[model samples]
Target: MKILLVEDEIEMKDSILQYLEMEKYLVEYASDFNLAMQKIHLYEYDCILIDIMIPHGTGLDLIQEIKKIRPKTGIIIISAKNSLDDKIDGLNLGADDYLPKPFYLPELNARIKALMRRNNYEGTSSIVFNEIEIIPEERKVLIHNTLVNLTTKEYDLLEYFLVNKDRVIQKNALVEHLWGDNADQFDNFDFIYNHVKNLRKKLLELQCNDYIKSIYGIGYSFKTIL
Candidate 1:
């Protein structure tokens, strides 16, 4: 999942970013409120960990912006304030959860997972679609109860397709998501096509009808309906 950490403290932001990266999550850091807004406007994140005390603007304003920008985005307020009104206001502003400063990184991870479950997962860790099954917590996938051998990128692509089944995913978005911001620096998107070919071959080998559609000028989409 993609995450944005909006914190003014450089040290804390670096530590949290390192930890989340170690956990295999895509993380972007914004040390101040302006940078935070810029990142938020540019990309969509599964969650935003906003520090209430930020330079230029308060994190509360971010919550309101997220409501308009990415309404499905999960939010967690991490503030040093330990007052009832602070928590209440954040909650009222639509924060899924609030964590105070000086909390353990593991606890923060747990909270992110919990909020993901509440919002995205709908209380489940595994995603079920036709014959494909994905256990997000374990980063595991199965096709008709048979495990498909996949490289890390292949697996990520499949999971992403499953999440947005029947939606046309752009080629550039896949490149950036898998290869980070420097994807355009590469020669081409042939590697993405190769992975898609392999995934399609494997699914067909298993007789799974769900397949990705090439949108000619666009990219690919996971088709569910006939």
Candidate 2:
């Protein structure tokens, strides 16, 4: 899943971003309100983690602004202010959950996972489709109870395809998600083709049906109705 982390604390922001990345989440960080605003306007996030105290504006304002256009956008308010009024205000303003300061990262991660499950996965830890089972927490894929060994990039690409199955995913989005935000430096997408080739081979070797389809001039799709 992709997460937008908005915070001003250097240490906290770095720690959270690194942890999420290690957990195989695509994360974008914004140190101040303006940077945060720019990202909210530019990209879509599965969940947004906002710190109430920021350099230029309170995270409250950000949640309000984002909720206007993105009601389905999952939001969590993290703040040092744990007063009853603050909690009430955040929840009333459409923030999903409020996490007080000095909380553990594991707890925060759990909260995010729960929010994703409620909003997207309908409160499930694993996604099941036909003979394929995806364990998001473990980042593992099981085909009919047998483990399918995949490279890290291959696994992430497969997960991304599974989530957006039957929808066309642009090559640019794949590059951005797999590489860092700046993937334009690449001369071509030969690397992507390599991964796709290898992933297809592994699935075929496991006797799993191939689901990825090319769009000719556009991109690829993980179609189920095929």
* CA lDDT of each prediction against the hidden true structure: 0.84, 0.85
- Give the TM-score comparing model 2 with the true structure, all chains together: 0.90
TM-score of each: 0.90, 0.90
lDDT of 2 by residue, 128-209 (tens): 8777888888889898889999988898888878878898987877887676555768987757878888998888788888
Q: Which window of 10 residues has the lowest lDDT sum in candidate 1?
A: 175-184
lDDT of 1 by residue, 133-216 (tens): 878777777889988777777778887787777888888878777765457598877667888988888878987885788888
Q: List the residue pairs that clash in candidate 1.
A: none
